[model samples]
Target: MEQQRAAHSTEAVVGMVAQTFLRDRHQFVGELSQLMRTQLPVLDRDERLRELMEAGTTDNLMEILQFLQNEAGEDDVRAPERALAYARILAQRDVPAAALIRAYRVGQAGFLDTGMRYAIEFGGGGPVTTSAIVHIVNRTSVYIDRVCEQVGVAYEDERDRWSGNRSGLQRQWVTRLLDGTVTDTDAAEQYLRYPLSRGHLGIRAWTGPQLDPATAATVFDQLRTALTTVFGRAHATLVVPVDDHEIRMWLAWPAGTAVDSGAIARALTARGVPVRVAIGGYGTGLAGFRRTAAQAGRVRRLALLGGDHGARVLAHADVAAVALLAGDIEALREFVADQLGELAVDNERNLWLRETLRVFLAVNRSYAAAATRLAVHRNTVQYRVRQALDMIGPHADVPGGDLYPRLALQATELLGTAVLRPEPDRN
Candidate 1:
């Protein structure tokens, strides 16, 4: 008899809770919306979030009411199923699960408050009433915890699947083109909407750390704008999001249009963020597109490896010799030592002498021209040249034995030596 009485009281209280929820559902959702605005600014500005919150809150209340009225088993799965749908919707709209989870928590509090108000106003404050109210709150709390867990798992799975689909499709086309397996040029050009016959300037831009979707989109937008400014506003541009941290772009222009790599470099460096941009020389035709993209990728790798730490923009043409030598570090190191000899010591005095000698060779051993370029007297140029020859032996002579030394010194200046290498400032 006591157990029967307890069951009857529980049913009555649950009926009252259901009645109160139905009466105040609008107000309940409104209160949830208010809480969202205060705690989650992103959802406050989103219409999808508003609809999702209202629907999810209503679902939870109805599910709990049904469970209580029917004495339904705990494993009915309605609550978790609704939560999974809510998660899929949120993922589709690109809303973070944190916001939805927070919304659920806030809505749970509001639901409990409504039930408590009904317990006081409809049932009065008695021992049985207190027990029923506590029981209702505990059950509702457990249900919400289960719902949140289900939603989190669903959201993560859906988000990964969506991202994988997008990247997989993009990767297929890009990889095919890169590997030179695209047999139908017309179909490929039509799909990409880029001219296969025109020249292509490939660029790869990336940040050090992975970026959130919103931030990555913003960064890519800025990069596109900078490209338009350098290339042309009307140029056909192809952008491929390689991943969360990297983007590859190709700007197609006419055959005769000149691309100023230096100007593009300046714009990227002034972007007020730590970005590394690699620019590949313009190539004509379908073959050119792949070649340039490959070059940009190499330059980006070198930049990421601290070889170009101080360089904001690296051009393949400028780093061609260094890139070739980078494959064999030991050989390059030995070559630098042999070429610069004592001058490769990385001291200020040695650097000065090396610079004079480089300029002297650059102008066909014209001491007067090197002096004019260096803004020093001709005799000073002559003195440095004689000193450089002494340090490097007869190999420093121009037009005969100096070719390799000149090339190595140029490589050292471009890519720095293996030890005490110079950081790339701006390429």
Candidate 2:
């Protein structure tokens, strides 16, 4: 009877600590979300997805807190709706199931740390504290195990359902091709119905979320028609939808046919669709297909990062240097600031100077050529180049002279507002 009373007392103390955490649930959830993002960078990819993950985290935490507060039996436990939804979304995004499982494990560690800290504070570091900590550990472990099982099931179900469909099959093949996992070219060609031996140009086309689904579909269709018209209908083309707003396409031409990316861009522009397109260089066979697709993907990422400064149609060859630097954006931004100094400022005057200097340098410092490109007089090009040099300070005088400054200018040109200093807010 005495032992039973001691056990009951520990349970009550655990409930009290849980109540304290529940009252400050928002703070705990915020910390847990940050921890998850830090440990698993994939969770930080999309704002909407991050928000969903937060909601699911909140729901899961609340359920666990409630279970602790009421001393609820294991039979009463179940995974929350939001948590299941998050699992399904992860699966749809092609996130590995291991990531989903790792999130729960990370969350469990964070919660346990918080719970242990609160237990000592609530119990004043005594036998009661020890008992409460033990109870919290045992209960939390069981809770995580049960929730993970349910979520894992949801993830697998969604993965299987998603991959069983036609688009999913296409995505699978494309993924295999891109990753260089497909060894049998004949089998892949048979499945995709697009020739693998011909010259291939990969394309990525997407639009902002502002377009409704029907309109986006129409725009994509127009994009397809434009491609066929420019590349000729005789060539085999394969279009695979990456998501509701984006697609991955490959245009295959007869071996040795030169691909005119400029013509393709003009065609897309003439169509006037809201879609933004990225194209990769022509490659022949499986190696070329993979290389071109990878390049297009990198260009797409660079374009997205470029935001308002990105062109409607971008080719990988044009921005290959910038694409290499896009992966570590913070470092690139820092380098831009370091190299250009005050000229990196995103005001009108600075922008004018930067462009003039960039053109002047591009033409081997020929004032006449720079003037022709800028549609300004030779004097204006010379004057702007001097002013840009002054603004850039001594950093522009590196050992290689124009080499470093040229790279910074190209980054500024391609990235636009992304690498430039923001105009200060007067408000």
Model 2 Cα shift for residue 19 (angstroms): 22
How many angstroms is residue 220 displaced in model 2 relative to the true structure, after the best TM-score fit? 2.4
Tens digit of lDDT per residue, candidate 1, span 47-154? 334555666666777777665566545555355454566576566546788888887887778777877877665555677578778877877876777777778888
lDDT of 2 by residue, 208-301 (tens): 6556657877999998898778767747888887655678999886655555657876887787877888888879989999899989988888
Model 2: CA > 4 A from native: 1-35, 44-89, 97-161, 212-215, 254-266, 376-378, 393-400, 421-427
- The superposed Cα distance between candidate 2 and the true structure at residue 143, in angstroms, equals 17
TM-scores of the models, in the given order?
Answer: 0.54, 0.67
Candidate 1 lDDT at 104 equals: 80
